[model samples]
Target: MLALSAVHETLGKILEPPTLHTAVIFTPAGQLVSWQSNPLCAKDDVHLVIGLSGDAWQGAREKGYGMVHHNHLGKILVVPVEDVERKPGEDKPPLMLLALNATDEMEWADMQVKGKALGAALTKSWSKHREHLTVPKPPQSSVAILTGSKRVTTR
Candidate 1:
């Protein structure tokens, strides 16, 4: 089972290089699970993130896509991690909210790639390790990337 530390580590590594400012992993009810933020971020920032993400999550559910928003501050993305195949009466979260705040517009483009990658990694990792971990970290053991039409699987 993975630990919270591992989840934070994965988020740090993924957001640090891309100049992303902050991220919060929250539940559908807006409760925080984990987060990583630069020194510039404040606790209030987290609330704003959750508020935006919660609304976006609802929209995403209706539209059937990840939610990305641009604002004067930068960009915000909310992604839901849900298990469609789970049985009834489970204790798992309905969906997790992943909210990101980038530093600039250019970083938004970079975020799309890294954000989706992070979402995918977390979704897979969490489902596999949820029995013991509050949140899942990206795999640290091996790295894989797509090379051709064959398609690579990392989950």
Candidate 2:
């Protein structure tokens, strides 16, 4: 939980100007461990589980564009305000939702050069704090197979 908080704080500071409206960290079981920001919509609508189950996350991952940081594995769904209509009596102003799929590999290279370094730094710090978080280990056979070649695997 502390790790998530750290990430939220760090990212919030880094991503200036067009600030992030919300940031959540969920467990593998779909429990919302920690979060930062105003959740204007219903819980189920912004649930991490739903995001993961959808094709958007899978498509991003398959294209090597997963999480903002390379350490965690998850999807980032950027929902612009213009795309959604405001509800009646909802006084809160609409802001873009920056969902970070923490379970996915951090894809810093995909980000702008100015933001890449900060993202990398955050990923490094977050990894240290969340040392208990388990990352999927690469298959040993794959490492051996690629030992002498520059060819990449497509799967």
Query: Which candidate ranks first by lDDT, i.e. highest?
Result: 1
Residue 18 error, candidate 2, Å: 7.4
Find the candidate with the highest TM-score and give its number: 1
Q: What tens digits encode model 2's per-residue C-alpha lDDT throughout 1-155?
A: 34455655754553322223344444323445444543333566447433552334344533322333322333344221111333555533212123443223333343333233443454444444333544345676665235465765644
Clashing pairs in 1: none
Per-residue alpha-carbon lDDT of model 1 for 109-131, expressed as tens digits? 56667776777777776766444
* Each model's total of backbone clashes: 0, 10
Candidate 1 error regions (>4 Å):
62-72, 84-94, 107-109, 129-155
What does candidate 2 score in Cα RMSD to the true structure? 16.9
Cα-based TM-score, every candidate: 0.66, 0.38
Runs of candidate 2 exceeding 4 Å displacement: 1-4, 14-20, 27-31, 38-41, 48-54, 66-119, 129-131, 135-155
